[model samples]
Target: MTVYKTYTIGVTITGAANGIGPILQNNLGDDLFIPAITTGLTSFTFSTPVLDGAAYSVTQRIRAKAPSQDCSSITPVSGTVNGADVTVSITCVLSTVVPKFAFVTNSAADTVSAFNIDGVSGNLTAATPTPTTASGAVPSAVFVDPTGQFAYVTNKDANSVTVYGINPDSGVLTVIDADGATADFQPSIATGYAPMSIAVHPSGKFAYVANELNLAGGNSISAYSINITSGALTAIDADGATDGNQASIATGVEPYAITIDPLGKFAYVANYASYNVSAYTIDQITGALTPVADSPFAAGSNTHSIVIDPTGKYAYAANGGGDISAYSIGGAGALTQIVCANGVLTTCSGSNYVAGSAPRSIAVDPYTGLYAYVANSGGGVSAFGIDPATGALSAIDADAATPGDNLTIAAGSVPISINVDPSGQFVYVANLFSDNISVYSIGVGGALTPLPTLSLSTGSGPTSVTTTQ
Candidate 1:
């Protein structure tokens, strides 16, 4: 002679329409949750029940007519029934992440090509709102801010930085001035002479540009503070904002490329004619640069561009004279050469790897930093595996015959600017002579698989390419 009883679970959902009825899952399905209030139901319970003292769990798998939201959190998710019922609450919020985008600066056509990167297929399609946006004269390089709110382009002939406001929903570009309209400051924010490359800080509060030529000094770097509310650039003082000789921070001849470390603590520039690299520490709050002690570090001849690895532990300089200069970054942001017995990358001669005919730019994998990619103005892109400990590099075995000896991946005629996407999924090269872009998916073991069909068409002469964060 015994008496038995059963207990049910209640699911209370908030922040959604009251009439929104959905079945709860995970041992609590089979019953429709009407929720509380104006449905006029004070206390409603699920139909399925466990025997008194049995265990139960509630999951956030809403079965019907639910908005796209995450409901992984369920209160009182699992427990044993103690002769009483249990209730779980759920709250829904919408997602804000927009689509990914890629930008290309066309030096010949004076326009920037914009495209949407497909997340599933890793393909580039023309972005909505438009295909290309007008830029200043001879646009050399493009950089998207960390917040994905704006894009800055360096116009070599225009000697200015063009600002474009990125459309959050469509990934389109609209010239943004101080007031978000008119061409007063929207078209060009005057910088130094022949602006070549642009880089933004990790905080998205500042941006810097490399000036290849100037009368104030041989070459200089221009710094600016970004407006938070509106995507505008204001030149910072003592960095050639007003063209004062005393205010300019001079660099070696023809500073062609600039980059900031992942932590936003340091900045480095490659001077083409100087045959060296300049290092500086960034002012976190003010965004100003102070030269590191033993400032200019030696690089290979005719250094065109420099890149700091994702880990911020090493740096590589791409020289137009057909070699890559590798270095280990010191604690104070100084560079020390990684010497190797042999000059070419036939093996892991760490110091300088014999690049293709004319190496224009170099980039390393973002996450592991295990691989490096180079764009050759001579012909194609070269792939190399990075030695993790010594920052040494050797060519990827494309043919499996001449391991670490020859380059196999072919690109456009003058592939100048090369970059790996932030996710480390793909590599993009701006072909200056071919007037197009070459696309490749990073395969296993840091090899490259060219996707000619997915390749993108650009304006006349594409000098630089970059992607949104």
Candidate 2:
């Protein structure tokens, strides 16, 4: 005989404004409220119906109107009521707008703040800072291991990678390794120049870093073997053998971003200076890379970012010169550019689909592989509906609305990076010039609508945003 088991996932909602707070209270059956709207002095609680044998994780998200104020001081009180287990918490108190999981500014003197998310209460609490020695002048992109035992951060300015041991109970970080001194064992011990991005393979056996150095003959990619037990990096191939030659294999220019295929058998790099992308075949045994056949596919002018769709059938690139191009990836890693109805490049061949000046980044919605978003530095984001069969793009709703639609939102001057949450329910844009984050809700039909905007703390230049599990 086989026994059946089930688990329950719960969610709670909160707000920073008076009108929305009351509306949320009325919509949710069990809810709580703080007496005043005063900054750094508000508290609230809410509960979900008792769910027996339900296994779930709780997270708290905040929607604030102001960007500079800190929301970390608020605390939550959550526990079991009757026989039901629950939790309460507060949200991240940031001076600038932070994407759900993107790297925020952190330094030895100024550590990025942490928060405790309550699965039961739908709240967050300020967490103690994990110690570090590197100057926090640059922000660190955060990536967690598959086993949840450790976390890794790529510090841009520090030109170093930091490892942290995760607390199982609270999901907070504790510094374990500050530099590559004790990375997982491989070969080389030297660090890559100006490491800007880090991605851990889906297998949890290796990690790759994208060095954004532009100095003559200085830029390249780095590979490492992951220490399963220690969560440290062990350099693999030295002499930059697998490093994409510090230029795009196709365009022969500087590379900026890197991503591995979902199958873990291949990798792709975005060539910032070459206006193209390079593909490489990965050695399953050693995690080393070799250029794929017919690689260095022409992407677009100043191609700086690339993302493979969830299905891995198509690849998209954000052309910094002002457009987004799509390509159909052949089974052998070859790229075939998709042509528009008018027989021109589908990315920006028409007036309606023309992207704003200087498109910086692109992110796809996980739930529906048919939708994608582009962050245009000229201001606002561009929404596109992907043609599944052709890998073509058709703009949705005429560029959508700018950062501020409902009520004059102060989006940092130049919007640089845009990311969609794992759930595909929200989209966050990082504005470099304005130093703010713009939030938007994704509609059922793949359209983007604006949400409340928030500013970062003083001196925080928001760059990239990612979500953590």
Candidate 3:
């Protein structure tokens, strides 16, 4: 005897109508019409047991008889059956609704571009009045805060950090005054000679800027306290005095980029001329920085960019010599080099991953924490898989080349910066020479499939790229 079980589904219709009915369908092409009720809740049962590891969708009828009439819509709230009992929730309403956005920074054009994100396809459409001008010059880096309420741009040429209030729904940018614009404070705010990179703490309470040029005493990291209410910034006092010099933490020569861990407990600066990464323990109370043990960790030549995995366990540096330096983050925020041994991370010779030509920037996929991607300034992009437990990088075959060098794919000419979207669904690369943004869809096992049709045209010298979707 083939005994079958039953699954019970309950429907709750908001704004329940008097004389309307909704239909429910299963994968087997069977429809069940649920009668309207004066009360909001009703229950229906199906006699067939659901197969394990199989997906079954129960859709609701959304048709209306007359325009603007009281027609109820149906939706699957929950549906599952187990043991001797079955339970599910099917929701219905008159109608339901929603929206999304993306942003791009153009360095040469001195502007920022906004786009509307298509939820289904992840495609971008230019927003009205596209390419908003930057308030400062040579905007080298842009950071949209975690709250998605504010944006910070570091203008290398102007030696200033520009603040902007973000539109939550439309992804628009409007400059905010950080120097006594909202509240009266001591002197106006400013950055170093060439602020090359900017990073906001996860707590949304501090912002760090890397001053890349050699000013008299200006080659340092600037610290600022964020005004959460107004989305403004105020310089932190280095000595905890109002009259003392503004907070400036000195680093190796020509620091090019900075990154803070997701935990907000540590920060790192990649020094281009110094060939090292400066590590620091963040002062949570004052936003000041203190050097960690073995302060400056040695890296390859022309260290350009640094990134920490979402797990907070490993850190990587993209060097100009076509290789990536791997490090194991210590408890006190110190970095220890991770030497690769026979495709695994171990204490061995050569503590780096050979990458594409002139690797400039790198990003770790936040979803699996198992992959890292680098943008090669010489030409294309490179991919590597991270050993989660050991923090060593294993080369992922570009197509299926087993036991080969690091996998490389032609993305664009002179790809400078690369970043993964928040959803971990797509990767964007800013090609300096090509003057366009290349879009790639992330696939299983960390493969990148280029969506050539979706390549977005940008202003000249799109040196940096970031997203706030």
lDDT of 1 at 149: 83
Q: Compare candidates 2 and 3 on lDDT and give the better one.
A: 3
What's the C-alpha lDDT at position 454 in model 1?
32
Writing each residue's lDDT as its tens digit, candidate 3 over 402-456 gives: 3444368777778999987755667778888777888777777777777754357
Model 3: CA > 4 A from native = 1-100, 180-188, 238-246, 342-349, 399-406
Q: Name the candidate that leads on lDDT.
A: 1
Worst 10-residue lDDT window, candidate 3: 61-70
Ranking by lDDT: 1, 3, 2
What is the lDDT of every predicted structure here?
0.75, 0.56, 0.72
**Structure candidate 1, residue pairs in collision:** none
What lDDT is obtained when candidate 1 is compared to the true structure? Answer: 0.75
| Candidate 3 structure lDDT | 0.72
Q: How high is the lDDT of residue 298 in model 2?
A: 82
Candidate 3: residue 454 lDDT (0-100)? 38
Which portions of model 1 show Cα errors greater than 4 Å?
A: 1-99, 178-185, 238-247, 341-350, 398-406
Tens digits of per-residue lDDT, candidate 2, 243-265, equal: 53222122236677777665566
Find the 10 residues in a row with the least total lDDT in model 2: 19-28
| TM-scores of all candidate predictions against the true structure | 0.74, 0.65, 0.74
